[model samples]
Target: MAINKLPIKKLVEFRRLSKGRQQTFANRLKVTKEANSGGGDYWVRSISTISNAFRVNDNALIKAKLEEVSNLYNAEQRSQTKKMYKRNIDILTKYQNFDFSEWWPSTSLNFLPKPQSILEMHGLPIQIRPQQIFSYGAENNQSVGGIWLITWLQGYKDEDLGIYSEALFRYLSSYYSEDYIINPAACMVVDISKMKVIGYDKVIDGEIPSLLDASIAKIKAHLN
Candidate 1:
């Protein structure tokens, strides 16, 4: 049997959905064996720019990338692609002035490749993929790191943010614990739309694991 795969953001959204919606999502997942690649390059361009900016400590790259997209938006003739480019332009413009130093003062960011691991839930192999990982300096001279999952969707409640943070924390702690100490300060879900960061320290729900397990069980049942 082929194992099911879900990005961390989709899994978090699934957890917050109503029972009816969960089943609907599960049915869609079951039938859609291939990855959905229909979305435009807005997220792809933006994420790459953000990653490159951190890797080289150059915020200018952000504006540079925005200009590239803006130029394309201006000349595009297709309405749909033009709309996508326009949206990307707006998002990149907002992010161009963002100060990474404010959130990660005095720390260096070294970007690692995206991480993925298979999680067995209710006798099912569910692959979880988080977007980015970076190692940063800590106060005690300890080597610690964090995983960041970006979300373009808006209106995520605090509870949703907490669940997303906890899920990313568990993914790193379970898979990469031997390599580096996963710091709560490092793990985060970056809300690009609102220019907000939700860190692992904000995960207040002690029952997150149980909640996730229940959500997984429901997903498994619906898969059948």
Candidate 2:
């Protein structure tokens, strides 16, 4: 359903399977609002990976070929084949119209606005701000990475509000894939308003075993 995030090292090798076409798509992917013609290895790899992983058939290749056949000068000679191919391609093309390459990393800066909105919607403090975020180590490094935030909510008074932690995790997990956030390298929760360290956690293996509860607990403990 989604293109999951791979480690920088793994993503590099994966993209190489397309002989650097992944980079080309990556370049076009960020700014482009929609899928277009003229794809490369990245596009092929994404379709292949999703098809195999999800046990679904990807007919984009077939559809493109069928369209080419339909446009041939002697298409009337192979009218039966053309009709059948057109029927199938048209049905499959709807699902295939979307590009999977866009999922490899997020393409929208809208993710930045969600935390504050969700927090406000839940009546939590509005002072939350991102301290550090993760990246895929590219030229722009636009992928959503780990998040560290400084918040004004007094941990001692609001430590029981699991909603705060849940809101952050939910927003990130929803926009980005669960694979993108399986583990964050470092997450620091600080209280600069009081000039203190609320809590800090780093995962060598990048695993968030307990999700938000783990981070919330660590930071709350510091407040105690």
Candidate 3:
């Protein structure tokens, strides 16, 4: 591997390339159009608002900084959710503070990939930028009775669900699960009937479902 420094030309070239792949910017454009909120580059300001800026190319620099941002975001969300979960627990157990840390994200909600190519969804505290992960795997970690919760993160603005759903289902049939016997080259089974688990594509064309859905489903499957 070699480290290539970006010259003026390279920078310009890279900027064009990146701007084309500017997912966040495209999203901002959509939201502004949809909400009609007198848009004034809120997302731009948010990115610029980072305290200590680091170079884009350095992996260590990017990871550390992004993780720091994510930690703060994920922790806050978990705490808020914990408060609610605590209330629920109290309602059930008569105000006993049962530990809600069970799933209340020690880290933050971010997509982390392991050595085995099994991407694990973690407690996402901060915003996960593009460089943080490549592709998504299953949703969150609580796999009960050999079933997994898979979520497709939004790809583009409008049909983000379709992008992820299509990609993830393909992954299931081609690599991980191999639901049915499709052509080796065109190697994904399009239908769910042949799937091993009682899998789904319900929210494939929408926002991601919480990992708890998988957990609850596991419990329900056991009860049945």
Candidate 4:
């Protein structure tokens, strides 16, 4: 099949196939089906169907194939063909990381929002600023990308207790920035009832931060 000729419907058909069949098609298309830890196939399939419904037919796999195609054939001819589908291909590629699960908030959570709400339920307030265009070192000196509905916690004014601040800082820093970034210094958790602040230095200001060492364990400990 011509690399540039695969339509959106074809991808929809491929996406609907069983994992084994999808793997076979992936081999044929010369596209790497990157594996996610859980439900990767479902995500890929769902997104492909959504894109197809919108009549998007830009083939990212084809562009990579074109690079290979160029090595063997006339470069000028292939470049002209690429221009025809470049827009669709560019858009589809940009949405490759789309997560439907995260895009829609849980109705069950009463629209409380994820991560932040999750933290709140556990008696921690995640302070996220109003949505801004640029999050990382952009318009302002703020370092957070703030892509998630909730990004950084609020500044420590009323919550200026030392232990909480230190614990929050450690937790924020340990997180990956692939999706969003959080400020380590500015921490404003809304709920502090569960957190038993024993003393500074021992828990918060010591050489090792308890939040960092047992972030999950601490949460579970609190529940018990």
TM-score list, all predictions? 0.80, 0.25, 0.20, 0.21
Q: Between 2 and 3, whose TM-score is larger?
A: 2
lDDT of 4: 0.32
lDDT of 1 by residue, 158-193 (tens): 556665676677777776677767887567766665
Question: How well is each residue in 9-85 modelled by candidate 2, as lDDT tens digits?
Answer: 22222223353555454444334532232222222322333333222223455455446534652455566655544
Model with the higher lDDT, candidate 2 or 4? 2
Q: Which whole-number lDDT from 0 to 100 does residue 162 have in model 1? A: 62
Please tell me which model should have the higher TM-score, number 2 or number 4: 2
Off by over 4 Å in 2: 1-116, 119-134, 138-143, 146-166, 178-182, 185-187, 194-224
Q: Given candidate 2, what's the lDDT at residue 46?
A: 25
Q: Where in model 3 is the C-alpha error above 4 Å?
A: 1-158, 176-179, 182-224
lDDT of 3: 0.26
Cα-based lDDT at residue 25, candidate 3: 34
**C-alpha local distance difference test of each model:** 0.63, 0.33, 0.26, 0.32
C-alpha lDDT (0 to 100) for residue 116 of candidate 2: 34
* Residue-level error in angstroms, candidate 1, position 159: 2.7
- Go through the candidates in order and give the clash count of each: 0, 3, 10, 2
TM-score of 2: 0.25
**Stretches > 4 Å off in candidate 1:** 1-3, 13-18, 34-42, 110-117, 121-127, 138-141, 147-149, 153-155, 204-211
Candidate 4, residues 1-224, lDDT tens digits: the string is 11223221232344346757755654554342221122223223323333332222234443444344334334435664544334233433443443423321221111112233112213332222211112234333334311111101221222233334444443344342443445533232221122122222343445434443233233223223
